[model samples]
Target: MIILGVDPGLTRCGVGVIEAGAHRRLSFVHVDVVRSSPDMSQDLRLLAIYNGLAAKIDRFAPDTVSIERVFAQENRNTVLGTAQAAGMAMLAAAQRGIPVALHTPTESKLAITGNGHALKPQMERMVARILGLNEPPTPADAADALAIAICHALRPAGALQGGEREQHLTPAQRQWAQAAQRSSGRGRRNADRGM
Candidate 1:
């Protein structure tokens, strides 16, 4: 299965493509950070990002697209831009009829480094080690994209299919799944309380 992972941003979007082979082996096919100038108009910037991601989807023909889920941030501008970029990624995948999955940064970090709070350098190192690269992918965004791809690639098939997947997950995956559940529960509780 070919998977395209996107780390979306208005200024710099990271794209990584990997192939999942038999026995869960992964081979990195491409990694790049697409850049847009801030000086450009917002609509133009978004267009640029969308075009860049769409081009990758067309070139790679991935069976699925994995993207970083945008989370709340203190900077509203940053959050808005990120959300917009993420929307572009979703649009590109949907236009091509490719399955799209969103993974949180914590989930990706835990899956890649066994720590939900892993630092940038740590994530870079683990991603490099997993891909058997001589060094980490550069500019943090590229590494993050690869990590997101790895997280989705390593996930059990049943997990995505809504069956008894827990029985097949590795120990680390179980932990990640449990944490995700707990996090979602908290969000629900907060929503119920009108927070």
Candidate 2:
């Protein structure tokens, strides 16, 4: 399947297109930035990003579109803007009837680095190795956007499909899951020690 991953931002959104097979050895088509002007109004910048992304989507004609889930931060404005940018990209894919998948940053980090809290540089290194690129993609944002795509690819297929939807887990859910994992690990350790 061909997947176009978007890292949506007003100043410079990053995009990466990858294709994979049933066993899913991924292939990279392109990874680059969509630049916008500094002096432009927010609306115009968004429009430019939308149009540029639409053009790339047209050019790639990917089978699926992957994007980062809208994340909440202390800065409401930042979250809203990222959500808006992501919304525009989703709309572009919706116009094509392509499936859209949202992945969390943690999921992306885990998929690429075996750790849920991987640094940007670590993610870039994994992306570079996964695609066998001579070097990592630039401007961290683009690498991050590509990470979003890679994250979706690593999801359990049944959970990803079959009418299931992604929930942008809250901090509480994350904490609970981590605590559960710790509990499970302790159980395993106890069993091993007894054995």
Q: How does residue 92 of candidate 1 score in lDDT?
A: 92
RMSD, one per candidate, in order: 7.3, 10.3
Candidate 2 local lDDT, 113-139, one digit each (tens): 999888878889999888778899776
Runs off by more than 4 Å, candidate 1: 156-195
Clashing pairs in 2: none
Q: List the global CA lDDT of all models.
A: 0.81, 0.74
Segments of candidate 2 deviating more than 4 angstroms: 161-195
What is the C-alpha RMSD, rounded to one decimal, of candidate 2? 10.3
TM-score of each: 0.80, 0.78
> Once model 2 is optimally superposed onto the true structure by TM-score, how far is the C-alpha of residue 97 displaced, in angstroms?
1.1
Q: How many residue pairs clash in each candidate at the backbone level?
A: 0, 0
